[model samples]
Target: MRLHEYEAEEIFSKYGINVPQGGLAKTTQEAVQIATNIGVPVVLKSQVLVGGRGKAGGVKIIDNLNDVERVVAEILKSEIKGFKPEGVLVLKKIEIKKEIYLGITIERTSGIPIIMLCSEGGVDIEEVAHRNPEKIFKLSVDTLQNLYSFQIINMVKKIGLTGKTLIGVVNTVFKLYQVFKKYDGLIAEINPLVITENHEIFCVDAVLEVDDSALFRHPELNKRKLNNMSERDKRLMEKGATFVKLDGNIGIICSGAGLAMTTMDLIKDYPSLAPANFLETGGGITSELMFDCMELVLEQPGLKAVLINLYGGINPIHEGAKGIAKIIREKKVNIPIVAKALGNRQEETWKTLEEAGVYVIKESETQKAVKFLSELLGVKK
Candidate 1:
């Protein structure tokens, strides 16, 4: 789950990563008090889960003590991209000599955590990647081994840091890696990891995102509510399924997470076609489960079609097909439904789905099936 900057900075402080003095305030009075305690020339940052807080005017700087209350009140009243601020982070502003980017995240294809560092920072890394991909340097971490200081030094040296600065940067990066490993973090980032005028390093902006699936292991971190979880998400969680709603027209159901993601990516490949949701029914599929999954998918509004990508590795494809067909018949679903069911009892599954008027594809390539779904939605490209 994504963490507010205040919360992320708190975690960073515990790991010996330097961060500007800050406190979280939910009220204007509290914000004023924190600002007074920390002294003036403070930055008032809106504690919103979404990004673009600066562009949305959710962030403001107050140099005068009298302006703290007014700025805090203004920020508290504002929302960033439809997400209201939960609180305001009052931090003492520091002078920056240089800004660098440091981040660690699990790479999808390799399933290995990769550390990304760039000399250009204080902005979205994605923008930098697209505009100047060569500026970013990546190092894949072997989860089984410790992240050595030498490895971090080698990567950062190429960015042209040496002497005391190199030592400090290496130490900070190593500590950040420790924090990433200890918290089961999906993403731990320190944007604009700054070098102050005094030549001291500090994490000016922090972002820590713990893996939701691994939250059970960290009781303290797990206490925070899973932000923005819908009733549909809660229901799916209770039923041993994973579902992520998206803004699109195709409802996707797959037997595996990889397949579900692959299907979503392929649908996105076509112009004007996107997957409406990611629904993965992990092992032990049955007709009843299939029927329930279909009902859930159909409940979503603005869905123009449904795509089912299932593999019968250890699942009963024929039996699951019965449940899907049963639900479509009962609900009288008119939107196009396509199923690419492959594996054991494939022909039987095909017969059941086709008889229920659901288009069936017996091919191994999911792109072909996705193209067919795009055609049904009048978005084939």
Candidate 2:
């Protein structure tokens, strides 16, 4: 549910936040036209989800039409952080007197939205926080009251804002907080919220990550999807399987989000194991859904083995085992599957797997399961 810069800017603009005029272009000619329309000294930015676009040569300054065409051609031809550049955002370049970073994200430990502001901008916020923690100001907003005016004013003052620009910064913070609450956003950020040479404040870059669970409430936001998903991802989604491809080779299928994440973390503990996807079948999933999930995992060419770790609380373990056996037999899948079933109906699940001649580890411990799966893949320890 991460949005592209243009998409995020559109949301920000709706909330009365100031953003530079820009348009998305799919071709070099279209990009050149957009630059010409926005006037000279435009910035050509690749609309990819990955970061470090400038370091990766996905961003360039176009002083004229020639630079526009040249830069657009280069950006469109480049790949940043493994994501192929598909489109370019041509935006009016501004003369910045200063750059600041402002963002809001859910705190994993506290389960609260934390607002972060820093005077250092135009760089990775994480790097800044890591190097100089004192410079970054953090405020946790109470979900009950949302963001208050005094809190916003305090944050701006902490960042040392002054004059009319201070008022603009305070207003932007208020508007951004409203947008975050309105959309049930997981994250909303404006990197390098810049002060122009004329003392006007504007968001130079924007990023928003809407909570996927909240998508049903916002039809308009749902339609504004960005083309950030990969070809395999699109295929998996179309097939009705909950799939999230990861950097590892071990394919994981669990019945809960907690278990799926735990499986991934356990795999990381072993040097030789890397999970390929975070596939959750969810509780009470039918045999058909199980078949779909298994098929999706097997579709990955790099998948070395499949791990089925289900603590069936609501779901009957026998049904899950039966589904796995059905998919394996019907699809003639060759990848090794290691099953670790626990919780209600565990005996029935083990019996079903044994009857089907599937590898049943009969372990409730996640670490032991990881060890067994790693060994099955010819990895020691």
Candidate 3:
């Protein structure tokens, strides 16, 4: 699960990573009070999970008193990518002489934790890497072992650091790694991990995505749902279904992870066709549950089309078809839904979809299905 910047900053401090002084505020008055107490030169950040906050007017620096209340009020009411702010973080803005990026994430294929660092920070590291790969440095780390001093020195050198600055960065990286391992994090990152004119380094921004699978070991996180999940998501989770909303137009429903992922990948490759979510109905889900799942998928924001990619080797297509039919019979769906189901009773399944007026695509013609959906949406790539 992903964490808000404030929550991640709290975790950073707990792991001994220095961060700017700040507190979360839920109201304009609270923000004004906090800013008053902290003095001027504070930054107001939107607590939403989506990116491009700066461009969205979710981030503002208050160097003057007249703009403090106005900026905070604007931010508190702002929406970024269809997500309204829960609140604004009133953080002490730090003076930066330089910005650095440091992050540790698992290498998907290798299953090894890798430390990625770049002196070119403050901006999106992925964009930096895409435009200039040589600027980003990477090393795969064995989390089971302690970081060696030599390894820390190597990172410092690659980022062009020396003296006290090098020592501070080394310590920061060490603590950041500790936070990563302790939380079973998929990503523990500090963007614009800044260096002040005073020569002190502080993590000005943080983004942490924890391993949801490992949350069982961190019971507190499970109990609280990381305080990030919406009530709808929490209820869905209790039903053994997984749904993650994304900024896309196509709502995806499938039985297994691999099929759903592959379908999503194919759709992404197509111009103007993006998967809205990863909604896995799981194996042996009842028709009633499938009905509910589709209902939920239909309600998804920014959804223009639905794609049901099903393989019925173990999850019989007949039963899956029954669920799809249930949705057709009960729900009033305006969006076009296309499905590709195979196994158990292919003929019967195709008949079911045809009867429900659901379009069917051959399992071998996956790319064709994606193309059909893209054209059906009438959107530009």
Which candidate should be chosen as best, given lDDT against the real structure? 1
Task: Count clashing residue pairs in model 2.
Answer: 0
Q: Can you write out model 3's per-residue Cα lDDT over 1-381, one digit (the tens) per residue?
A: 777898899989998888988789999888888888888899999998777889978898889866878888888777787788988999888988999899999998899999999988888887898898998988889767877878978977987898888889989998988889889998999998898877799999999988877889888777766466656566566667777667688899987877788889989886667888888876575566677678778876677789987777766677668878888777767678898887767788889888898889866667777777777776545
lDDT (tens digit, per residue) of candidate 2 on 1-381: 777788889889989999988789999889878877789889889998756788878888877678788778888888774567668988899889999999999998899988889999898997998899999998898888757778888888998997788888889888888888889988899998999978888898999888866877987776554254545455545544466655567889888778888889989887777888889875475566676677777866567888888887777777778778888888887877888888788898898777766678776798888888888777874
Winner of 2 and 3 under lDDT: 3
> So what's the TM-score on candidate 2?
0.75
- Whole-model lDDT, model 2: 0.81
Candidate 3: Cα lDDT at 169: 90
Worst 10 residues of 1 by lDDT: 225-234
Instruction: Tell me the tens digit of each residue's lDDT in model 1 across 241-347.
Output: 77655557789999999899999999889877777778998767789778878987887767889999999976898999999999988999999999999998899
Task: Kindly report which residue stretches of model 2 are placed more than 4 angstroms away from their true locations once superposed.
Answer: 77-82, 224-253, 261-279, 283-308, 313-362, 367-381
Top-scoring candidate (TM-score): 3
* Full ranking by TM-score: 3, 2, 1
Q: Provide the overall lDDT of each model, using Cα atoms, as 2-decimal numbers.
A: 0.86, 0.81, 0.83
Poorest 10 consecutive residues by lDDT, candidate 3: 226-235
